[model samples]
Target: MDADTPRRHDASPGQVPHDLLATAELVAGGALRSRDRMWRAGVALGRPLAYALPTTGAGSPPMAGAATLLLCFPFDLEEMPAGCGYRKIELAVTFDDESLRALDLQPGAGWAGPDGARVTAFGLGRNRLRWTFEAPRTGGTLSPDGRWAQAVLASPAPLTDVSGRVQVRGVIEHPLLSGTRAEGEVRTRDEVPFSLTRADVWAAAPLAGRTPRPGAWALTGHESIGPPGERLPPGRQHLCLAVDIEKYSTRGNADMIRLQRSLLRVMRAACARAAVDWDACGRQAQGDGYLLVLPPETDDTRAVPHLLDGLAGALAAVNREPHGGTRSPLRTRMRAAFHHGIVHEGDSGYAGSAVVELFRMLDADPLRALLADDQSTDLVVAFSDRTYQDLVPQGYEGLSPVGFKRTDIRVKQFAGVAWIRSHGHAGPPPPDLTAPV
Candidate 1:
């Protein structure tokens, strides 16, 4: 070959592994597809991650945060991708606010992150609009790495103050798995309360025969209400369980994402095996932690053992396999708190002294110290005196008080007694717990 022949770019410079680019292609046309099949086939990849954020934008009429609610899902293709918003959704929204008159919403989906992305206008009729967005494109919206593809709600039109709550049912279909319609899976849906003030965001309602203006709705905010849902009555007493990933903030976004997925699976699987009806429980997501308000009928006998044992078994199984991500394999370890008390639904979330006490136990100095000192342990639970007395002393089927040790908890304005238990060994309480209180 002539030396002057524009040698392949690979040979032109120091470029290495030039053929690596040969592998990039659209999987759509392939006869076999969807992430679900891969999951069923024993792939260790975690399930999809999604959540809803409700924000009130500032405008002539303060837009209802629900209108500016951002619907997020995930999509992967080449470096750049194109998609239609509604094709991948199968969700039903039930809200109690009667004054929520429909205002114009923006439609038309492209990438929803960065200056390079665009959210065009689309008229909404009967208010059934949500977009499963591009993850990488909208990294700026939710995730830093473009994991949550987002569809911002059209506009807010709350005639009165938010007097009721909104609930989302059904699942967000994975675009790649259009062939397999998985049902009743634990979908990622959370309420993000926003009090930001802006309007001129959502254009006019683009109902029938009307076209929504492109790039008209751009909802923005800084402060947000932590994600939580008070699905049960506050005065009602039930079992409360809360769990947090140890050292969650120390991990990168990718690791955090993987851990969150694993944690959910562990929770759901444990509940199922324990015969706990997860849906019946009032729940909330606390970034790195999760709280559950068990069903009123929950039998402490079965609930305690099942919840703890299931968590341990599931954690062992998942830890054996690497979760979804490019980082090193992540091992699941958490600190859990269990207490039985009356919980109330606050405007932002479930509030009450019970909620506060549960957190105090979970974050108790002894619990944190035990987890930190014992690296081999995967989980440590601090059961309030109420929980310990109800289960362990009553001779429940799976309850064993063998290694549990009494630990005094004094956090903030609360002072109480808690029993600490790790997988098989309960470490000594922190110095503070033993110090003069």
Candidate 2:
């Protein structure tokens, strides 16, 4: 039979079968409990299949190891006139196999609905049961139609022979502005069901600097930034960045200073070439001896690429310089991190906070300090328009008129040479040292 077909059954009064009644009793008594084991089992069955099934659709298949028995009744919503009421309540029977089905057997013969409830029996092997109810005058709550398919699975064997019923309730709503909102609940036999309301999904459209290049690094996170009716300039926007830096050193304070200076020079030059406004930037010295900030940038697409190129040149120059040895480990680490999108972009305000937090965490870890010290100096560059606005200088705060539309580039390093060259030195240093050899 087609999965959508509804089954109908009318059990004689007082002659209702025990198994059928037991299933009803379990549901009525709210006996189906959610256990950690059950949840894990459901996950094991549903996770793999989640990819194949439509995440948001009525005809979508149910989670694995789940069986559904729904009964439908006809009711006029205009009569009840209560708040959005339910026209139907679908009863689900989730089990692993035929043996478990025996646990639900009723002594009597046929089946019947509870006074006003409607019933249906469509599946052949006791694997399917569907019911429909005519919603009361008040509208009925909408749920994921996929659950209908998920409710019909063989009972899973218990880990320790302990069994409980779990009610997984999900509400799905679609609004004109915000798109779709889906909320889920998991209720155990004993404890109250809790809603899983965390919003973890984020999405972003491709920006200008970065193209959807095949065989490039994995693109995972996505989020929508602007609200409907929010005015935005028309143009393709993309932001791509990489970071590299030298390692940090606890014992070598002098070496650390030298390395940090090199990193700072690279960052400053990159910002300048990118047309970023330094006066509007905010700087912070992390307790771990690293500096973090979000300098302002012109609202131009070319800013990110220029910053990246400048940073690369700065790293190469630092490596060849003769100040306190060739290169430092901290710089190398920063560079590697940048290449992999490890650093967060500081565009205006909170955008850069995540990166700063990560840096602070690394500073707090003793092992990280040692590794940063010994490893080659690396670079971390996050390109964006929103860095921490709080970090920006007050006078220049409103200078970034573009708001969230600007491009930002962030650079991080453990230690490197300073941006400014010491005076009284030779003329222009060596050509090979300064140039990208």
Question: Which TM-score value belongs to model 2?
Answer: 0.25
Q: Give the per-residue lDDT of model 2 (tens digit) for 1-437.
A: 33212211222221111101111011112332323111110100011011111123332222221222111111111111222222343333333334433212211123333233333333334533333322223333532111212221223432112122222221111122234322223211221111111111111122335422111111121223566677643222212232323345442544443444444455554555455643333333322233333333334334544554455555544554433212334332343111111233222222343354334323333323433443332333322223223222223422222222222222344321111000111112222222110
Output the number of the TM-score-best candidate. Answer: 1
Counting clashing residue pairs in each candidate, in order, gives 21, 131
Question: For every model shown, what is its TM-score relative to the native structure?
Answer: 0.53, 0.25
User: Which portions of model 1 miss their true places by more than 4 Å?
Assistant: 1-71, 75-146, 151-234, 324-327, 424-437
Q: What CA RMSD would candidate 1 show?
A: 17.9
Report the lDDT tens digits of candidate 1 across residue range 1-437: 43211112111121111111011111221233444432210011111221123343322333333453333333222122222121122122223443233343333545354423344333244333343332233222222232332233333453222222111222222324555432222222332121212321221221224343321222222223335663544387888889999888988765676566567666765676567865567767677888888988888787887778777766665565422222245566899988998887554467788889999998889999998888777888898998788788777787788879999999888899999978732222122111110
Q: Give the best candidate by lDDT.
A: 1
lDDT against true structure, model 2: 0.28
| lDDT for position 427 in model 1 | 25
Q: How does residue 75 of candidate 1 score in lDDT? A: 24
